[model samples]
Target: MSLLRRWFDPIRSRWFFQKPTRQEVLPTEQGLSIYLRLDDVYSYLAVQQLPQLEEILTDDLKPLKVVISDTAAEPPNGMTKTEWHTYCLNDAKILATQHRFSYDEEKPEQPTQEALKQAETILKNTPLTGQNFLYLLEDVFHMLWQQQYGKLRTLFVMASQHQKPQETPERVFDHTPVLASYFEFGGRKYHAVDDLLRLTRRLKQQKLLTDNPIFLINHIEWREHLMSDAEELAEIQAMHPELDLYIALEDPISWLLLAYIKEELADYYNIQMNLYPLSYRSRDHFDWSLATRLSKRAEVEFTPFCRPTADSILEMAHLFYSVPDDEQVDAMYEILKAVWTKGKDFSFKSHFQQMQQLLSIEQLTDVNVAELLARNDALCDQKHQPDFPVLELRINGKHYVFNSLYRVWMIESIFSNVLEQLYKSENDAENNEFEISKE
Candidate 1:
């Protein structure tokens, strides 16, 4: 059997191989609860798109808005305060461009408690409809982004006298201050443009799609941009770059990503690749269920994952980096496939012997292994990355970090300028060869 079939066949049979079933949504239960933070730019963007979304989804979208404080929001994926701010702001701008919305370049000041109270009053007074609520939402964002305190205060005061409490569903998590700009539907949370697309897909799957299926704005079609082999080879030959990947051996996503890079990206890019293996900050924070689901959905999914301990993960990293430079890639590939696909227990003496034999290594030592792991941990800290399987692409001096497999297309977008230059170089080379052959 082919290696691909060997790895994925078990997972396909055990996890997601069953006949497809359309999810059922009761008429009364069809509601999209949107949680918004008053000061969040992404929230404003989502609000802007809601009118069109409502038009498409029709009355089935039972819209509910939950206002929260951005200041009290938790940093997702363990990012530091500053790092989270930078990423959100930058990502918001990119999303705005994709959605054709004007994003303010300057970071807006945080709204005061008084401002939020006034805003709540307005929300309480205004009827929640596609047109009514969206207009009010736009005005609110304008007031916040433009720092129109006097106008905002007056509006709030005017609405306060007529304020009536608006009821909505209870919040999901017990986190004191909630994360901003997420939509919850059928017990799943989705945030931002990418996730909104996923949410739309779910609605369709549930047979809840309205007669008019509106195209989701700001949604980048990533799969359509996958380069052909000739194109990839030409680009690689024209412009060689480097890739630095931070991954955790215990992470199923990381293993899947490694397989992808090896099969689709390795030979196509004449680039220096650096793999930094890391341990999770907190194993409890890892979502095992989600990981399993994602692994099952992967094109080259592996099953029977042998969960590795922190020590075992570190040992694997040490062993991987200890191998000869020419043999490192093959060694890492074999190790991961064995562990995840074949369920090889890395902690066992027999498995260690098997790996050593596969790598043709006479002996292995753990010299400086602790120090190496510490260095990897320190790198994660420096980058303000709290998650595993992050791909950081450094071109010249700038680094772009991508946290999910879905964002691989963003990497291609980032390399567009270089790709263009490479394309021109390729054209010039072909022209030169043509002239020489004609002579």
Candidate 2:
């Protein structure tokens, strides 16, 4: 391990980072502080689950609603506005179907001020517990997102009577621009279904759950179910499909994902892989360090503390772009591994020489490294993306943008169908059915 890795490994491996003990009591407040925006699709889905979540926790569940700034919500760490919008809608559809929540793709009215006013009225008059507050929240969210204007008019009239007080409720709007629904409990923050599942597990461990059966309706399975049999692999490998991967050298998540692709999916299927080195300025809104830590938590093989400088990132990108088309993927893989796994400084001449040796090349003479960097930068600009490691798999002329490794299964599922169709058409033999194993 490098000095950086050695120093940070123990810190990152702290007890808090590990799975919580059954006896471990959370060290913060007793209730759940949900940060929400009425316009956010994720918020709507999360709110729908609150009734169930509250039923499980009972008195322990003190759900405080904090309305966030909707207009200020930006695309996730490395997504374009268009891409983000598409992803949100698609993800919402899948989640809504799974959770049996109603969702519409059409743009909903901005109900932040109205919802806040109503929430304030409820908090001032009614006790912030039981089904009343939950019902109010559900109604407000449904009215705004689902356009279920059933009792909203009566609720609005009742809310309007309560003078929109000079001092709003203690849990008034905190104007943070959040992209998704998240909960803060005992100093720890939980976002979306996955994080909420973790919180649920912790609560269960603490014996916080009443006799009610806890339903983690939104929990998503992370593992990708792929063919393990030799015959199945051979059959799939016959039909070659293309996987276009867009990566940013500076991103820790990209590094981890690249490593995962190389180790797991590289030879698993007969896919023509096209690697694109994406270049873009880092966003002021995102915390790269936090993302790095999160990536490490997701994949323990990831370097916990290593971060390459801007010049180093550019130099690495130049080397990546300068390589031959066939050698580019391997070259990029090695460069990422050096900085992210091996913790080698990209600025050093020795590291560059090592990378060159790994690439089995004397020097990159075919392309000007500086010019290649400029070209990649321009391509990144043209894409108009704000995030890193955006993977767009084009199958049958249709493009799907998958954000995380968890969604790799969805890609594989689609690939299975595509491969089966191609195989059947070629063979014209219904006798040999290509079974896409879910396990």
Candidate 3:
């Protein structure tokens, strides 16, 4: 780890998360406050869930407030506004499908500026605090996502802006919207479904959740269900899905992901995972603090005993390549655990010897560590994403590169989609054959 990271990681992990935003530390009194804006797909998805959220919160946390931001955030770097908008729509569709939420599977029309103005006019006119806000907002989201512009236009015209509503809670949500939509409770923000579940779990700990067993829907169905028999497993294997998992020795998330993929995914599927060790800048998506939070959530042990040096990383890289492809998974796990958890610094000769003995590895005479790393780096360079734990998924004759460890779930999703396509194509062939026979 670099000197900056060494100092910064701990502080970020410790202080940054603990400090609440300037918003009201008033989960008890302020209830649940949601912030959203038009033309944001996640805002639409989040609005769908609020009616359920409003039902479950205690009387103290009743009345969900919707704070409409004037504008959506700029697209992430490297993407045009159109590209970002398209990506968000597609991404939101996936989330909608995953959560079984109400959504149009086809590309929905963007809300016209006039429609946005009308919706905003209705929302701002509606009481800024109460369940009524969520109901009206839900109607707006449904109309927007379902492409019911005519109904939205009628509602906009008929809806009463004449009812003046109190806006005392506006003082609490002063910050601009960064992501699509999020809930502010007790001065902290909880994002769409995943983080919303986290918030409810926190409430459950306080014995504040209703008797309703409000649990997050598990979106990723493990292959154990999809592959019912040897025949199905064979068919899935025929799809030729390949995962190129890139990890960094210094990154804690890389260690977490190696174990996750090996245990959660690799064991069940015939997919080949080509491991590479090329790391770049950390994306805002998953900082060390978030990784550590997920660590506790996953019940995985994550403790850094020593920061790796450049010399140590090179030595470890050579050691990594020395292991055969089949045994590399186990070897990688041991190497990471040793340096990260067991304090076996590979830079020291004694520690290096211990690890070599552990993996039963001999420094191969033909292995060129520098050449191998360069090759991997060059192959990975094709993916324009600059982040650690980069997953290059090649499946069903298509290539998809995801830049975060948070998205390991996509592997299973792709497999499911591919399986559906295979089944559909096979049925079509069988029908064609029968039609030819009949003729």
Candidate 4:
């Protein structure tokens, strides 16, 4: 439901239904102190909304010293604030020629401990306002670039503006190190796979995976969704930044940092956030039509295999929410192997067909299809998962253990397995029916 309609509902409770407040909008720091703008949610999740403040706080970026600045600010009086920063960069350059500076004017020098201490003090005390930060960053970049341009062989950039929406793919050839593409959802058309793939290749040329990272800044539209095309641009960058580039998703880039941490510390700090699974709104939960399209477009495998049999669907559905009290979820593996082994003939497409037939049979078995449909609709309204304390049946008949979180994942797995079996069964039934009709 829309936010507006929720407020007007007769059962409205102000506190529970309140829209996001400013205080609520800001995320808290959990393991890391990663402060991000209220925007910047879409880089990770596929959902259309931002996570709760609690979830955001727990995100991987929580520990970084995040610096959020307003992109636009006018200068003092008649002049703009940005003008001053530009002027300062110019002044610093002019001063460097006349003043006694260390190292080459073009190349930066490695400082002594005392010099390092002084530089640290300068960085800490400098007022990094709208205009000044970039200039300061440029000076540092120039120094670093001169020192290791050949060795590093990478480009670093931070783009703050959104690219125009109507710009064609052909026009995107004039790409920079970090090009911000504007994208807004709700009404904007999705880019074609060819366009996206081409853009990804182009970004790869810019060394997205190199030591230098291209940062594309954009506004938050639908919480986790991008307000502009920056999401598209970022996606391209992520495909292959350097030879092995890393795309930092959220403001804090927890996964990127975790890749460096020792395994002991990493395991201790880990928590899975993408835990919940979307349930079926209708009897078509096993449908793979859309999944097939998406997987094909991405050039990735997305097959759901299963063995045929009415019993297997029920077993799979039961297992979907099933969890054992033991500490391991090994039982699910046994079940998967057993089902596929039994239905050796089932392929991905055939399995989906079986699922549709199974659901159809259930519907037909009911005396009142309309009444059952209504009840099904009601059930759909409530978000129910396999109740906690789920059970798992292993091949050895030895039960493994699971917690609520593990159970949630187990249910999804079972659903996939069950779909595979049911779909195959349905395809077999259809082939038989077709043969009979021809005879």
Candidate 5:
């Protein structure tokens, strides 16, 4: 077994939960309204769950009507899944249709030309804070009210993770005279699981509701349940033939449970996942399809990389090549373009040649491991100690010790910077010569 497989073997054992055998629609007594907020890990799952939830709500319960807040009306702060579910219930009472937000043309316009202009002026002049959420909420409510939708029975709001409930007595729950019964739904929280469960229980008890009807959709994380080595995930999979489960785990101590109740479950489930690290915000022209194809491969698995915004590819590029920021950005671009080139997959021998071509390394004479390590050591000595030591390179067949050719990656990046500087320097020289000749 490889290092990756050895690292992931324990994870496969711990996440051995049996998938539910039957397709379960959340059983609800009252009309059902689900508000699923998509965050990083669970966004894909939430999208998948939407069609099922929609079908059930429309075809089965057929509550008074389903209502969804327009994208603009998305809550400024996201609530707990419970809070969100309740919020949606509240919104549903006022608006009709649980589907995505759509315009109602039959309704008369509320603001006249003069009133609209005055409103815009007032909005521009007013200070904004928590009151902004309230203003947005009321704006939607008033619009629906004007159209004679009346307060709805069920409401669903999909808020961003950046937005959430705040601690302000006055600036809370924009809907005045909050709904009698509302259920908020959102993605899973690893750390806040107990808090979330407690909040759900408290809210349900407060409303005198039944058990387990409040749906909380979430993703698995590191440090969940642990399993003994005797228990393999495949053992659990064997028992649950009907259930569709997908698990994409990268850590042994804590597993990321990515159960996709859809196709491609077995392949992704209990597999060691890898995330690509890119420096600088270079995804604009990056080939997502290439990333996707690489991810599907059984050998040398790949997955979309997610690093925090500050440590993103863009930020990393900025960090690595800080001098002459414009040139740094150009170098970042060159690196990404090379990475995205279709034939640059690292699994095959031909791919390295393709990478070399993309990086313009084919023509360079003195690009190898020993030379590169010497250069790296000198740079490290100048900087202080040896933080950025020798470059680690993996070539097909055998290890070829050349200068920074081993540090081909770092070299390519530096070359990118050099290319940008050369362009700028040449341009500057041309302008200076033109001025002198004219004089």
Candidate 6:
């Protein structure tokens, strides 16, 4: 990241998230509003929390405004639209099971287009506003997600045939996925799922809550169930799913994540990991402030650091590839700590020499740093809307990719999936053995 980009990105985001759409009804200064879509899995999860959110907001001044967005952003994670929706459905199911959200386990994993169409029609016609809209919207989400097409149609017909909506809810949707369904409060935007914890903190900061309330969202925590079953995870590790991580050496979030993988995950899970280093930040898709917040949740130390000069990044990139395969993890982790945690400026001759000697790097001759970064770029390009510190997992011809900066706890979630597969395979094998003995 350039020195200028370090400052400009946040400023640009602040302006972008708060800027009104062309047709947006201007919000009252203190109004709490959200934009939701009928098809978004997370939007369904957000609706489940409204009663709790309302309780938390009881002492506050305004009812939450609901925007029924009509469009969606491109699917993330290099997935086709169908693939992204499928992942969201499965992910939300896990979230529901873990957090006790209302979900119909027997319902289809992905809602059919017919189901979504009924929801859109009903939501478009429902006679409600403020908390009344909140009341009906939950039922709408419930019926749609639970595959209650018959009940949804009844609701839709009842809504369309006899209802008199005093005002129609406007359709204003942005292509940005985060904006597709999010809360706007105190001039800041919060993604309804990942940023739920952050939103609560902001509320407390503004004195909306005098202290921590009885209501808390625990989904952001590392799945405690996954952590409890170390023996199962150890068994699954033998399957050898590979975690390919791409990092931009100068980015602080990369350092923090590297520490978490080493400090928090290394002992508990055994999987082959390959690390690739880049001399530059993955600019466009990167989320900056959110990355810092994620670091806090991961419980890794992070400190603000000067953006490394171009020269320093080049030197470090070359040193990383020069290291033996067995030594790469330690070499990369040390580099991350010195620059990110200690604010060491490897651009300085003294600092550069010290880093080289500390990591036991030998003198370089004809080092091709550009080619190394190009290789990183090629791997990173394999992702859709790729960002620095990308984490990709490959197992049994299936890929699970997590944007580590957005959801640090997702790594745990990934392992949970792995364990589930391993257990099922083991059970099937045992059944086969028993059948053979009987034969």
Candidate that scores best on lDDT: 3
Overall local distance difference test of candidate 5: 0.29
Residue lDDT tens for model 2, 217-272:
43334334445667766766675657777776666677777776666676777666
RMSD of every prediction: 7.1, 7.0, 5.4, 25.6, 22.6, 6.7
TM per prediction: 0.78, 0.73, 0.77, 0.20, 0.20, 0.74
Q: Tens digits of per-residue lDDT for model 5 on 220-302?
A: 21222222233333443333322111111111000111111111332322322211222222223323333333233212222
| lDDT at 144, model 1 | 67
Arranged by lDDT, best first? 3, 6, 1, 2, 5, 4
Looking at candidate 3, the ten consecutive residues that score lowest on lDDT are: 17-26
Q: Is candidate 2 or candidate 3 better by TM-score?
A: 3
Question: How would the candidate models be sorted by TM-score, starting from the highest?
Answer: 1, 3, 6, 2, 5, 4
- Among all windows of ten consecutive residues in candidate 5, which has the lowest summed lDDT? 246-255
TM-score leader: 1
At residue 149, give the lDDT of candidate 2. Answer: 49
- C-alpha lDDT of candidate 4 relative to the true structure: 0.27
Better of 2 and 6 by lDDT: 6
Worst 10 residues of 4 by lDDT: 242-251
Where does model 2 exceed 4 Å of error?
A: 1-26, 58-87, 97-100, 105-128, 158-177, 205-239, 280-300, 377-386, 404-410, 413-439
Better of 1 and 2 by lDDT: 1
Candidate 1 collision pairs: none
Candidates 3 and 4 compared: the better one by TM-score is 3
Clash number for candidate 3: 0
Of the two candidates 4 and 6, the one with more favorable TM-score, higher being better, is 6
Candidate 4 lDDT tens digits, 136-220 = 4334333332353332222211111222222221111121221111221122222211122222233234322222222112211
Clashing pairs in 6: none
Assess the local accuracy of residue 202 in candidate 4 as a C-alpha lDDT between 0 and 100: 32
